[model samples]
Target: MRRLADASAPERRKWYARGAFFHAEDLHYLKFLIGEGARVLELGCGTGELLAALRPRYGVGVDFSAGMIGEAHKAHPHLTFLVGDIEDEAFIRQLPGPFDVILVVDTLGAVDDCQGMFENLHALCARETRLIVGYFSHLWYPALKAAETLGLKMPQPAQNILSPADVGSLVALADFEAVKSERRLLLPARVFGLGRLFNRFIAPLPLVSSLCLRHYTVCRSLRHRSADVRSASIVVPARNERGNIEPAVQRIPRFVEDLEIVFVEGHSQDGTWAEIERVRAVYPHYDIKAVKQPGKGKSDAVFAGFEVARGDVLIILDADLTVPPEQMPKFWEAIRSGKGEFVNGSRLVYPLEVQAMRFLNLIANKIFSILFTWLLSQRFTDTLCGSKALRRSDYARLKAARGYFGEFDPFGDFELIFGASKLGLKAVEIPIRYASRTYGQTQISRFRHGVMLLRMVVFAFLRIKAM
Candidate 1:
């Protein structure tokens, strides 16, 4: 295997240039999976082309073959290249790293001990690091062999043909959790722009997606965490819930000693802002803060509150008090214990209170839940639940990357949901009993919001799946 790799080192650029279109597609998906300016480490990085294309702030490429490392250094002098066996425990442990993203593209199948390689990779990962593995689908083995025989691709030594399921199992065996997995690239070569159309539209469809050529799985180390207790910030986006202001604070369980509650009133006419101020004054013992949102929707209000929040963990609490404040502790514990990086409240699990949700709304929530489960590759029982928790640092990362989706969400639910999915945060849902509002009418319009949701579904498809 080493001899074959060494012999092909001289022609590496030639082969990649011949298949420029195919390679470009792979790079497109990789760029989407990895953010720019991250600390990156790539194993079996042949010629370092992919690593250089990623534009990492600090980039390192390692390969077992000296010829490949030499070529990589000559081609991309900005990146560090080293010739070392990835399966060697001593060699892998000596590297300096806690990289933000690690790439193992098509390298696992060539290694003798895949599980050992994955275990060694844990040394290079922090809690937020993501391990991305991209490989060719075993179903395309015959086509790849034919291309190699025809001199259209680089020749390779005999290697294992692993499926997505196989890779997922190996990840689990190495104590890593598989967060997301998918297949793409229906057409490897671009033929008069039809390849782009088919790959973008028809290739990602349900049954059709399974037949694609490329497979990618993203995993994160499960054992990486800190045991320190984190502070908490709960932002309540209030509209007209004047009567529920004081009770919202009082009902909250003492989840943590260092906690701050922020109330963002959104141009309510029912004296909600005055009620928030009164509650702040009355609760001298509790740390309460009130602020009027500069904008109209719940999304704006929540973000406004987040801007001023000073806590290790940030949570959203609906001012309507439908999802009881008592449930806040569950979210806090879920995040603090490292059970999940993002904790979402699920109202669909337990029985609903009288008039908690209307018939149509319940049906819509179920349908959206299914759609989001498919779209995000993470199961979501309730997508629009206003109660959620995530570390403030994760929120800052998500907020920085928010420009990709733009300001599309008005209810504030999809903003966090989409952001969490993009950041590869481990999502865990906590079951909570749903209750009807006691003070004010619901701020939702069934038909109008339903139409808007349909639009969001289409928008998400274009932004997430089609891309």
Candidate 2:
């Protein structure tokens, strides 16, 4: 602490101006983590390069050195600045309230007390907070030493050499989950064509990108949420098929532990709501609620039902019964096994009931599956057969990040798929038998819905693949 106090302000300023190793680091980080209009707090924002790159409308930069804070203020005049130790609870207390994205670039490695820093940062985040942390990898310590010796990168102090697991442990101790952790380089694309090649070939592949230059960690804030394992939301959006309600509920496999049924009666000319109420009366033992959709379509109806749902796991079950209730246990098993954050039902793999899908539908499903697999770098065997499962915690993250895709999706498939892709969640598909809908006429307008699907595909290309 004495040596740090005696360190000349001009020395720190010179070091910052030189911009060693991490000059362009924030550009990628801002593109990947901190999107526009987000409220962001940056710890140890020396020279404020990342702060300026993110262009946060509500940005706050913190640093311990008065010189660093001055330089940050000069470099990024728009952002608010507070010169204080990140570990100081009283200092964090004096600042403003919670932020959406809190960054700690190159802060943890230098902190004298890493545990204190983690505890304090946990206090600054809400349940939906995202923290992007990166530091030079200790695995590359030899290369760094070699580079410094060769005078490529400057070296002076004995910086703390830590592993990715060390940082992740600290994050977990802070009560946040490490959603994504990766290693990226300071190397330029032009100079290293092979590096760029890896980005195209191997990096986009699921599960391989985690080990690439410096250690990068993306953490989600913690909430003491209880999984009302029994309070299940079964959403069945039905249309002209008025006869399916009672059978759907009765046939819906009792896979979940605690269950409640919410029937989203969407624009059905048939007495779907009346039938739902009839079913509720018949099965007084079941927790059943019927809501006639004020909206027009399945996507809108699903969103509406979700708004009124009070459950831990929100499930989408098509009224057509293409996916039987008995198969839901497979989804539960996939989720419980921690195979994926989102468990999508794949009808293409298993044998479907004869006449399950028309020839064109099967072809379209296969084509879109290939395209999305290529685009999001995640495999999906079927995209249109509307059955998806995820936790409410994940749904909250999607809601918070809705601006990323806006309200353009009408099918509801893009919402979860795109959200999970961007959030770096492991999306797994479970094979299920597709039973042809027994009760209702199909509501999907082939041409109109196909066009919407095409629009979503293009939108997803830009949002997930191109970006």
Candidate 3:
């Protein structure tokens, strides 16, 4: 650490410029992980370049090297910079915290005690705060060493060379849960047109992404402060599922203080709306409400129900009842216990019941799952699952960002998934047993819908990946 302080600004600038392409990739990825106007604190923020680019409402940068801090303060006057060691608990205790985002980019490998750093960061985080750690992949150590020896890269002291799993374990020991992890920057150096193609398309693929130059992990504190005790509102968007309405109302379990059921009936040819009213009448003890959707798609109905929902947690349950309402407790428990911020149902993990899903639809689901997992940089086994859960506040944030994807999603799944990813919410997939519907014909047109899904995939690429 003392050696870093001894280095001059010009020498550091030359060294950093040698890996300009790599730094650019890191900046782009970090911007995506953090939202606008967030209060951000960056550890080891050399020159404060990345912090300044984020345009944070409140930004504080800390580095042990006095030279680096001086350069950062000079370069980024808008942000606060101080020379302090993160490993020093006394110094960390003095810093104002509870930041929205805490960044430790490219500094974990240089730390003497990774767990101690995380523990100190824990004190600076709230329940909603996210800690993003970026480190070089140990697999690239030999190549990096060779580049340094040839003067193509900056020379550095011996690094700890920690793997993603090692960091994850350390995070857990420090009372933080790992939310998401990804590998990036497959083409570290610029190569004209080829670099964009490889990094944007080829490098994100499963087998190829493992060989990327850098790895990032996003984590959150394990303490359940805001969601310790909450109520729930289950929103069921029904099109032509009159037969299952009563059973859904009866089977939905209660795991919170109060549970309200909101059924948004789409324009169904059958008496689905009447059935919803009848169920409310039959179960007068249950807090149930029904509304007719003025629009066409399930997405419209979902938004309508959410508008009237009055609970701490909001949930989406399909009217077809393929995913049993009995599983609602698991979703509630997950968010309430702080296991995940966005809970998505995954039907692919378990064996499906007979005729649960048609062969063609199943195949399409599997294909889209893989494509979406790659696009979102998050593992999603069942992208079309209807049973999803999240906090009401989180849903409000997603609603505000809906214009990014526009009103294109008819199934209502991708909109939430994309929004959650954009907000950097921790998405957790809960495995559920899928069953065949007992009543009403299937509404999906396999061929037409499949084509629309393909178009959505392309849209995702343009919006999410191409950027």
Q: What TM-score against the true fold does each predicted structure earn? A: 0.98, 0.67, 0.91
By TM-score, the candidates rank as 1, 3, 2
Worst 10 residues of 1 by lDDT: 222-231
lDDT of 1 at 41: 96
Q: Give lDDT per model, in order.
A: 0.90, 0.72, 0.86
Superposed model 2: Cα runs more than 4 Å off: 1-25, 28-32, 35-230, 255-258, 329-340, 377-379, 423-426
lDDT of 3 by residue, 1-467 (tens): 56755485547777777778878878887887787799999998877888898999999999888888888877889889989888999888888888999999889878999998898886788878889989988999999999989998877778889888888999999988887787778889888867767887777667888898888898888763347546899999999999989999888887766989999999888999888888888899999989998888888999899999998888999999999899999998888877788899999989999999988888989999999987887789999998999899889988988888877777888899999888778888999999999999877777987788788899888777665
The clash count for each model shown is: 0, 5, 0
Tell me which of candidates 1 and 3 scores higher on lDDT: 1
lDDT of 2 by residue, 222-281 (tens): 542123244467777777666877777778777766777788888777887778878899
- The candidate maximizing TM-score is 1
Each prediction's RMSD over C-alphas, in Å, is 1.1, 6.1, 2.5
